[model samples]
Each structure stands twice: as structure tokens, then as C-alpha cells.
Target: MSYEIKKQRILELIAEMVEIDVNEVKEDSDFADLGIDSLMALELAVYLERDYNIFIKEHELMNLRKVEDLLSFLKTN
Candidate 1:
């Protein structure tokens, strides 16, 4: 998938998880700022891994603190 499409999907998933509007999720927005706790982050990682057919280690998931971080990871991996 294209970067923009992947980004939008990720934002939508985050917004759905946090009960917020997708438009509120900026590329630079921190996951914590979006009200994502550790469990939520893990759940998002699972979704990303399943949807994108990629595996992400726990430590790597922990490091994805911002939307951009996840996007970059998705792009490269």
C-alpha cells in the first residue's frame, strides 16, 4: 500500500481505539497525547501486524511513541 493510505488507516485505527476523530490524529501526535495506554498500544501493534502481514517485536512497539514513528516503521518494514 501507499504511504498515505497506510497513514490514514493507522490514524483511523488510533482514532477508533481512543474514541476520537481521525482528523485529530496528526502525524507528529504522540500516542500518549492521543490517550493510548500500553494495552492500547499493544492492541494497535497487533492490528498493524495482522493487517500489514508484518511482525513487530515488543521493544520496537514500545518505541513507537508517535504517529510518525509508526508510519516510518511501516514504510521501511
Candidate 2:
């Protein structure tokens, strides 16, 4: 899939996980600011790994502070 499509899907996934509207998920917003705690972040990682066939290490999870960070990681990996 294209980067933009994947990015939008990731945002939608995050919005669903957080019980918020997709429109509220800003690309540059911190996950914490979007009400996504560590557990939620981990859950997101798990979902991505499972559904997208990608693996994410715990250390990498720590670096995903913002939506853009996560998107960038997904883009390259």
C-alpha cells in the first residue's frame, strides 16, 4: 500500500483504539496528548504487528512519541 493510505489506516486504527473520532488524530500530536497511554500504545503496536505483519521492539515503542514518529517507522519498516 501507499504511504498515505497506510498513514490514514494507522490514524484510523489509533482513533478506534482510543475511542475517538479519526479526525481528532493529528499527525504531529503526541500520543499522550491524544489520550494514548503506554498500554494503548503497546496495544496499537500489537495490532499493527499482527495485522500488518510487522514487528516492533520495546525500545522502538519508546521512541514513538508522536503520530508522525509512528508513521515514519511504519513507512520505512
lDDT of 1 by residue, 1-77 (tens): 78788888888999999999999999999999999999998898889778988688999989999999988898888
Model 2 misplaced regions, further than 4 Å: none
Per-residue CA lDDT of candidate 2, range 2-77, in tens? 7788788999999998889999999898999889999998899899888788788999999899999998898889
**Candidate 2: RMSD to truth:** 1.0
- The lDDT of model 1 is 0.89
Clashes of each: 0, 0
